[model samples]
Target: MGITDDAKDALSATGEKISRAVDDAREKVSDKVDEAQADAKVKHAEAERDATKAKNDYKEELRDHN
Candidate 1:
């Protein structure tokens, strides 16, 4: 009975540690996903600005040609 109780206690502790590790990993992955999303948004905005500038410059060139 003593050995059985000790084994049960050890199992419980090990289970708790595993659960904590899994939760920590989930939080880290979520944070990385958020960071990636923010980085993508910034890149998208920069690309849009560059595209607009190019379109305006093309229009100016066309006007000069006319």
Candidate 2:
């Protein structure tokens, strides 16, 4: 038989198992994406805070110099 026929037969035999596997894979990928997004947001916020602090400090130093 051709590959399509073989695949169909395999799906017929293991449809539920295959479906569960696909769902699990999708959930894992989604979780990883969400985790990465959250991490990026945290880093961005931290960088902004640090930049603001540095700018304020530099302004103070410049005023002292002047």
Candidate 3:
């Protein structure tokens, strides 16, 4: 009975460790996804800004020509 109790304890400890590891992995993946999304948003904003600037510059050039 003593040996059986020790085995159960060991298994329980191992299960806890595995659970913590899984949680850590999940958190890391979520953080990476959030970072990627933020980076995509920044890139999209930069593209829009560049497009607006180009449009304004083109309009200015046309006015100058006229």
lDDT of each: 1.00, 0.97, 1.00
Q: Write the per-residue lDDT of candidate 2 for residues 5-61, one digit (tens) a residue.
A: 999988887988888999999999999999999999999999999999999999999
Backbone collision count in every prediction?
A: 0, 0, 0
Evaluate residue 61 in candidate 2 and report its C-alpha lDDT on the 0 to 100 scale.
100
Query: In candidate 2, where is summed lDDT lowest over 10 consecutive residues?
Result: 9-18
lDDT of 3 by residue, 10-40 (tens): 9999999999999999999999999999999
TM-scores of the models, in the given order? 0.75, 0.72, 0.93
Residue ranges of candidate 2 with Cα displaced over 4 Å: 1-13
lDDT of candidate 1 at residue 10, scale 0 to 100: 100
Worst 10 residues of 1 by lDDT: 1-10
Candidate 2 colliding pairs: none
> In TM-score terms, which candidate is top?
3
Question: RMSD in Å for candidate 2, one decimal?
Answer: 6.0
Model 3 residue 62 CA deviation (Å) reads: 1.0
Instruction: Rank the models by TM-score, top first.
Output: 3, 1, 2
lDDT of 2 at 7: 97
